[model samples]
Target: MSRPGSPVCTPDWLALREPADHTARACDLADRLADRLGAWPGARDVVVRDLGCGTGSMGRWLAPRLARPQRWVLQDRDADLARRAAAATPVPATAVVGDLADLDTLAGTDVLVCSALLDLLTAPDVERLARLCADAGCAALLTLSVTGAVALDPVDPLDDDVTAAFDAHQRRDGLLGPDAPDVAAAAFARHGYAVHRGPSPWRLGPADAALAEEWLRGRVDAACAQEPALVGSAERFLARRLDALGAGGLHAEVGHADLLALPGTVR
Candidate 1:
């Protein structure tokens, strides 16, 4: 999947949406993870490796809830983003700048985590990640993978059309996109992980006008790109949506899923 908070990813976009992301994430999954780890008979300093960690938002949200003495490895392909992520991390962290294709190098890690990343990966890419995590016997907390379900208040006739086009665009070039969550869950299950899933939908309203506006624009643009014939209707639809947003009559629910996968007891 694509990296949202990494160097190739715009920091401003990530920063602008960070609060909403924090607000929308499945906190219960984190609690469930904490409880699972707590029940481990040999609890010790936990090691967490965040893949594609953009500005350390994952760490910021997960660290406090996890037990103390946690060491984080904030990994990204972008050095600048990695450095920034390290600087903002609340726990001790080592920032690694390298290819995400090399994730298998993180063998023996306790937990593997990522946010807004799985949707960019192809099925095989996710399979490889699952195999690596399974080999390491690590728990995984993967969050914010879009599920292709979005609701817009004051819905327009073209809303479903644009959304469908956008979902198709996301799956372009064989990327799993919104299908990643299900595919990854199955992959983890096949590898002997007990998987749990939770919904983490973004509820955007008038208070989030700026983010909502930008998000709407991107959605419309992607739809247009996916189906060039939709350009005319897309423009009209975007205008209506923006107008409703400005008038405080717009609300949106963007669907995302959080997954927790814990390796089963070793024989």
Candidate 2:
């Protein structure tokens, strides 16, 4: 479930920066998901529903490679993003403006894809979704969740406290709270979907200067918003990190899980 009125809470910095820079990382994660599932032996056409399909990033990455023509349904509450995603999709695709609670609107999809979305939902919501997917017999791909840890190049003492607080903030049950990958995996397991988890971290450095900067700014902004206590320090910390990146980009570890589950599979 999305936070009440928080659907639009997408940090401005992330909205502006992540689109292009995150493409490579998204593609790599998608490839890993595709390889894990391979071809579903019984399925002829693969129908994929990208839940929380922000600008159809996952669709852009995953559609071209399928042997069978893929039908993609990009679902998000944001109409503008839905329109943009519909326009960009290479395969047969449609966009739906609806919340995750309206996931029932989704039907007959072979794959249920939710990238960077699970972390935004509550645990119960995640479980409900898992059960729905199992009933529909759709495989799932959930990606790019914050693991609540940031490894700095020159380790900052405050790094641990800040990240931990941020993680706590993420897990807070305000409207939607933050549902981690572990919770999601367990939900899938309970629903009888064999779950496969892969950690795909965002590998950044000076080579990815633009993306790194965007990520840094977004991280700081999000951290501050989630934990207002850090607001005063976040900007300065973000600046320091950005400066270090000018010399050599910092490796920001973003913990992500690629969950692949088949219907009726046991733990």
Candidate 3:
């Protein structure tokens, strides 16, 4: 279920409609993850199960780097997305249409991957998922969870409040209650999975004016709608930032945590 005023789960926002170059920017982040984690012995020859695999973005980013052949299973609740993802993914990829609640269906994967998805699940759901992955002996990589702040310029007095409200909006659904990255990492650690954490922040500037604008629009829309009191203030703030962007440009920080977990403790 989606949270009130949350943009993450919206169909259009979730869709793979970003400009090719913009999409590449996002994909580049995943590529960095592959480089960082692929060195582990367990990562090779592993079957990757991508949960909430929207348009096969993760697959597109990670497939080329594997030394051994990888079997990527792209799973999502949207059948159309699954179909499209299957079509778009490189060879050696499969698509499954289902929800995360069906842990039984997730069996047989060596590695579990979910990008920008943990923040959408409840605590129980996360716990259940960690246990399931542990049972399957699957290493997991979960990424791109929002940290709830975007610094386009110098900080303002209301920045903290805006970010707090947005975080509340993300957790209001009760299912995914807050910084899911942190929660999921802890759950995995408890289940005996040694997890390494990394940060992937989208640092936008004049070079990324277009992508920055798109992200800003989505973020402002969600923030204002979630807290009506911030509507006017958000607009004013966005206007000033956009103007600044015309010259000095603005930087919106899209903070995410990259988690790498294995079956055994790191030696």
Candidate 4:
């Protein structure tokens, strides 16, 4: 999924949104994942490989919650981010700079985890991942996949048009975009894995002014990229939304979902 010109995630952007991402994750899925893994108190053999582990936020949030001694294998295309994640993690950790397949990293992996990643993959890419995990006999916890739903408070007439454009942009070049989670579920099921899905929408308000501002800016930009004709209205819309956000009168509910696919039949 590494495209030559794909937007690389910036550290500042990742840090700014970490809290919201943490709060928005599906706790029930993690709890259920824990139950499936069972209580392995003091067991240090549990291995969690975090693909696209941006600054190790997933590990920091989920490791302690698992309540088990485990090792973390953080992978990222960015060398710096991978190194930072390995260093910051509070457990025995290692960073893989290149592709996991290059290192054969998944051979003994117990769980595969990804966040905000599926939306960037194609349907065939997800199928390949599911097939790989099934072949490797490991579980997967994929989260924060957009479902093409966005609700902005104090609705504006231009909202729907811009949203439609952005959704189209996300799916351009054959990426799954909002449909990734569902596509992933069906793929895993075909491989005999028990699948679970849950909501992980980001509910932003004044408290999230900074993140909301950045997100709105990027969204409008993407929408404009998808449809050049939307330039004028998108500009006006972004300005109005920024004003509302600054005035503390705006709230946005961005739709996202989490999926847990475990090997074997439904429990």
Candidate 5:
């Protein structure tokens, strides 16, 4: 569900950061996923479902790295996004526009994957997801869930305030926000899934000035929205941050985590 102040994650935004997402993701986790899939019985092909599949970036990045002849289901609530995603996918992919909670749609899928999606979910929502995956006996690779830590070179005094507020805004409607990785790990663990986590932070530098600026703008906007009192300080901080970025004196590490959960053998 789209939050009130949450960024809409448009096709443009997804396209712009697709490379960064791919670069930041943990390749070792993907290898681990391949190893787990190798253990699955039978010679049948794999059914991979990408939830909240904005522009199908996840599929584009993950498909070629794994075994071939895979079927990809690009699922999203937005029809336009789903269509564009399906079109951009390198492999044979079908677009399904529906809620992620619809477990029937996920039935028969070997792996359920999502990117930048877990943090937007509430505790109950995440629990339901974990339960569904567990019941279906599918592995899950949920990537890019924010960790609520931002390290910026030439830091400003208001950095912490803005980050804290942005995180608050993320968790506004009971969403897990920065705490999602841990929460999801626990949820999957409760269902007997072995969860592995690794850092997948975005390291933005001078070459990524545009992306860095846009990201900073979003952070500042979210912070001001969460705490109106931070408006004045936010403006100043943003100005300084942007100036430093333009001069190649700014670098940022936006924290995120990649999670791979393998469901235990269903008794």
Candidate 6:
């Protein structure tokens, strides 16, 4: 089940990063997931249920890559996003308006997928997700979980400070934050899935200034929000950042991780 987050997702923002997201994702993991699903005894007809299908980005990225006839089920907490995602997805899609909870009803999906979603859940929530997937004997391809590492070219004096604060903000509400990928892998492994992980970092360069600037603003804003004391220098740091970005001299490598889990091991 995909849960909503504070400010991690929005249609416009999701659309803006789609290209980078696809590029940053580890293609090997997707290919591996496709192979596992291909051999799945239950996949006479493949069903990919994207939990929290915001902007439908996950489906658009994954469906064609799979070598099986599939039906996309895009579920979202926002009804409009659900319907819009269903309509815009390249493949035929069905939209369901809701979150995936109530484990009793988690069956019927051949494969589970979600992008940038695991971090929004708690450890118990993640364990439950793994358990549910294992019980249903479904494979999962969970992608783009933040890894709490941001490297910026021409680093600033306060870059580490801002990143630390931003990460703290991510963990403020007991959320997994950058710890999601590891936690998810362990959870899946504990529940009898053979889990695989690979780095999916966004390597942004001069051409990605727009996205980089937007990412910088959000990262700084979240940092300042978590620790208001960073404001004075943060404002100054932000200015220099914008100036560098405007001059096309800025680059950043934002960290993320992707996970692929195929059932059947220690159950």
What ranges in model 6 sit over 4 Å off?
1-8, 40-43, 102-104, 265-267
What TM-score goes with each of the models? Answer: 0.95, 0.82, 0.81, 0.94, 0.95, 0.93
lDDT tens digits by residue: candidate 5, 105-157: 35698899999999988899899999888878889999999999889987778
Please tell me which model should have the higher lDDT, number 2 or number 6: 6
Q: Would you list the rank order by lDDT, best first?
A: 1, 4, 5, 6, 3, 2
Tens digits of lDDT, candidate 3, 51-97: 88877776776666555567888888777777777788775777777
Off by over 4 Å in 1: 1-6, 41-43
lDDT at 2 for candidate 2? 42
Model 5 worst lDDT run, 10 consecutive residues: 1-10
Which residue segments of model 3 deviate by more than 4 Å? 1-45, 175-178, 265-267
RMSD of each: 2.1, 3.8, 4.4, 2.3, 2.2, 2.7
Error of 3 at 141 (Å): 1.0
Tens-place lDDT per residue, model 6, 134-162, is 87888899999999988988988998899
The order of the candidates by TM-score, greatest first, is: 1, 5, 4, 6, 2, 3
Model 2 lDDT tens row, 106-191: 46877888667777788778888888888777778776765554566777656875676666666666423334778888898988
Could you tally the backbone clashes for each prediction?
Answer: 3, 1, 4, 0, 0, 0
What is the lDDT of every predicted structure here? 0.89, 0.68, 0.69, 0.88, 0.87, 0.85
Q: At residue 134, give the lDDT of candidate 4.
A: 87
Q: Candidate 3, overall lDDT?
A: 0.69
Error of 6 at 177 (Å): 0.4
Off by over 4 Å in 2: 1-44, 174-179, 226-229, 265-267
The weakest ten consecutive residues by lDDT in model 3 span: 16-25
